[model samples]
Target: WRRKNENNNDDPDPIPCIALALALLYYFRLPTNEDNVQRNDRSTPSREEFGDVLSKYIPGFVEIIQNELEQFVNTDHFVIPHG
Candidate 1:
């Protein structure tokens, strides 16, 4: 089964999509401006907003990340030692 993007674009390989999601996650975690960001000045409410966003999306995305990690380990591409 295949899922279509909201704009009706079909992507058979979703790996890039997941990679972009991870990049977005990092972008959101970054301070408002540290040279990479267009917006400058980190404020209290901006930090709060970032937290709110993480709380909203992290749970769902975490599962997706976990599945990818499992695939890596199963394929021997990842060798994470047990603690």
Candidate 2:
């Protein structure tokens, strides 16, 4: 994707990119607080709620991330052999 856009030198539409990036980040359990002072605001959606909202735009996103995580954990990079 980067290489395809590199020569054109045109900035891509930021709104969708940012939205998708946020969705992906949220999927990975990362906090994306818009307001630090009101970070604990009750109106804010819970993690599951946030995921639900993202799911509307990104189908099967949660499952994909979870599967990737499982794969990582099962990989040798994440596993340690005790002597």
Q: Evaluate model 1: give its TM-score.
A: 0.32
**TM-score for candidate 2, residues paired by index:** 0.44
lDDT of 2 by residue, 28-68 (tens): 46444544225766565565667678778766656645654
Question: What lDDT, from 0 to 1, does candidate 2 have?
Answer: 0.54
- Runs in model 1 deviating more than 4 A are 1-16, 19-59, 78-83
TM-score for all models, in order of appearance? 0.32, 0.44
RMSD each, Å: 9.3, 9.4
lDDT of 1 by residue, 1-83 (tens): 23345455764556435544763566345553343344555453343344456546554444444554465556377556777
